[model samples]
Target: MTLALRLGKTLAELAGHQAPMTARELIFWMAFDQLSPISDRRSDVHAAQIATAVYQSQGAKVAFDDVLIDWSGEEEGVAEDDDALETLFAALSQS
Candidate 1:
């Protein structure tokens, strides 16, 4: 996968997190956050390798692409209007 793919995947994961993320997650996320507008530089490659290594240390024999790209086939949650509920009290707030 490309660096853009990596950054996007990492960002999506971070977005869904509601609780505190572990140091490993933070490290991994930050590593891929680089924009690298000039294409993959030497430092970026090193960062990618480090990110992959972090996963490998946890016993996952995954590649750089695997760690970076989202493997979940599930699509991002789309907001659907609940007309039935909206019709009701604007309904009970989940919060």
Candidate 2:
């Protein structure tokens, strides 16, 4: 499979676990996986750039921060960071 396919799959799996992740968390995940160190501050700009490239490759029109999303899909205003996800998950789990 292509890199885009791999990334999409990974993203889907991640999204499946919970709501959308923040750019910072996504960056961290990418860097942690050794894809690229888009996790740092200076690296953030580059990370966004790379994510945009990946997004385009996947034919996804939305950028990283457009909404709350998981592997299944997206919801408006959902963040992509652990804190935000945790809060959302907590609320969701209670329901």
Candidate 3:
């Protein structure tokens, strides 16, 4: 069993024991756990680890190549989407 598979299972169990969560709600929990990006560089690192764990727990057969970068081009798109979502949520919460 890979790490992602393990995390997926954990996440499923957590969901089963609680209400369904939105991405924003999940991110908020991450913040509550002191895992948000602003507090520490490790936060981002931890976030990726958490994501991988969730994938594994879910029984996905993901590999490094499956999750890792193919090229720098992929990063740009991902960063843009992440930034947009983060900004939107940040703004909404502030007001």
TM-score to native of every candidate shown: 0.27, 0.27, 0.26
Off by over 4 Å in 1: 1-40, 67-95
Candidate 1, residues 1-95, lDDT tens digits: the string is 25435565443355665455568765664664455333445455677789899988999888886545343555477445588658674446643
- How many pairs of residues collide in each model? 0, 8, 15
- Model 2 Cα lDDT, one tens digit per residue, 9-57: 4453555665455687566566655644322443555566777888879
Per-residue lDDT of 1-95 in model 3, one digit per residue for the tens? 12323365434345565545568756665764563333345454566567777898999876534554344475543545787899999999999
Which 10-residue span in candidate 3 carries the lowest summed lDDT?
1-10
Cα displacement (angstroms), candidate 3, residue 66, comes to 6.8
Residue runs of model 3 more than 4 Å from their true location after superposition: 1-39, 63-95
- The runs of at least 3 residues in candidate 2 whose Cα sits more than 4 Å from the true structure, single-residue gaps closed, are 1-40, 64-95
Error of 1 at 12 (Å): 47
**Model 2: ten consecutive residues of lowest lDDT:** 65-74
| True-structure RMSD, every candidate | 18.9, 17.7, 17.9
Model 1, residue 77: C-alpha shift (Å): 16
How many pairs of residues in model 3 come into backbone collision? 15
Query: What is the lDDT of every predicted structure here?
Result: 0.59, 0.59, 0.56
